[model samples]
Target: MPKDPANNICQTHIFEGIYNKYSKGLHDFLYYKYGVQTNPKDKTQEAFIKLWDNCKNVTLAKAKSFLFTVANNMVLNEIKHQKVVLNYQKKPQRTYTNETPEFLLEETQFLEKYKIALANLSEEQRVAFLLNKVEGKKHSDIAEQLGVTNKVVEYRIYTAFSKLKAELENFNIK
Candidate 1:
């Protein structure tokens, strides 16, 4: 049965009338504003779908304005998304080195052994060594912080280095 055009557009006949009336105009507006690359025809269908979904709330009188507004906003969002994609494509991509798997395995093994060797050191030796080497502090500065003599700080760091070198000697660190 045919629905009255002045009544609610929730009726199929009235909704079809709205689609037939506005679909072409909305498509043309989107195409002229955003170009063919943005797919104006698809956006036109989507706007109609939105209108149909919200048919209960939208009056027949306001249907044309609703479709145009939805279609225009959809095209604008697509254009903004395309701009972001283009900007991402314009940025330089990072290049990776082609290190051998065997070399990487050896490096990983060396690091594990190094951590174990560091853990094996006496607390005094580990603290002094890390403060001197990792923290880049002088022997006198380490001695002042640890409340020890400069010579004692020097001895601990030397012992820690000797132990680490002996323990990590078997693994090839690349």
Candidate 2:
């Protein structure tokens, strides 16, 4: 079928039409590739946004390639950044067969301090961080529950790390 020339990437209605047509597939793609750690919906939106941004250059026929490429790139970016978001996920405690009693005592004390440090974070940051690390939620899922975008969730997680890093700068958890 010939694409409607009017439905170029620059046209809002056309762009939305493409979004409506492919959003689910794009989402499924992200979900399958990134699992629950990332948000496919956000990536889909980002891909569409990029299409629109370069609308004049994009055609309805070429839309699929453009969207997939953009979405894939976004997913790759997320995978690359996973390490930074993981600062919130530390081992609560690790036991050794020949550990010293003094080491155990100090470990317990450090955990308490860590908890206190977590408690001090802004609610938004704390929630996002914990949901990602403790609950093992994807930014996409957390964003849906909180009625925010995945990027917002990412920011919250990032800020949480910044705050925790500053607060717990002195201690090195083992």
Candidate 3:
């Protein structure tokens, strides 16, 4: 079918208006969902561009949902790609000349074991653990930041800890 230039221009205006109104909210939503900043911005920008490209088919009332769906899918795809890259990356071990050979071998083994254990965790558990432990975010803060209930955040943390503890039980490194 032939395209309508006037309709396209009108749709572009509508999409621009929507983007101006909701860009901040969309960015925040993406950040909270992904626990990252740069990717969230990229996803938000991509979502807006998608909306602009498909504006003629979308109504104003459904624009927010469409943007969110696009952003969520983008984040998921990025995460999956990152996981694949991480899995294929070679592990880099640090060498210390001062350390005894036995100590160095044990340390390398322990590090590799820990990495394998961590990789076994569920995505939500891993994310919760990183946000709470690595990022030093409180459960309540993480809950609010992630748009979940505080109790759910606590549960996720507990689940993550239990799984990690079970996986590392043989190491006795605490």
Which of the predicted structures, 1 or 3, would earn the higher lDDT when compared with the native? Answer: 1
Q: Which order, best to worst by TM-score?
A: 1, 2, 3
lDDT for each of the candidates? 0.87, 0.83, 0.79
> RMSD (Cα, Å) of candidate 3?
17.6
Colliding pairs, model 1: none
- Ranking of predictions according to lDDT: 1, 2, 3
- List clash counts for every candidate, in order: 0, 0, 0
What candidate 2 gets wrong by more than 4 Å, as runs, is 1-7, 84-174
In Å, residue 54's CA in model 2 sits off its true spot by 0.9
What is candidate 1's CA lDDT for residue 22?
Answer: 83
lDDT of 2 at 104: 88
Worst 10 residues of 1 by lDDT: 165-174
Q: Residue-wise lDDT of candidate 3 within 1-174, one digit each (tens)?
A: 644564452465755778788899999988886677447888889998898777777667778898999889988888898888888775665555788989989888878878887789887788887899888989888988889998888888788788878877554322
lDDT, model 2, position 47 = 88
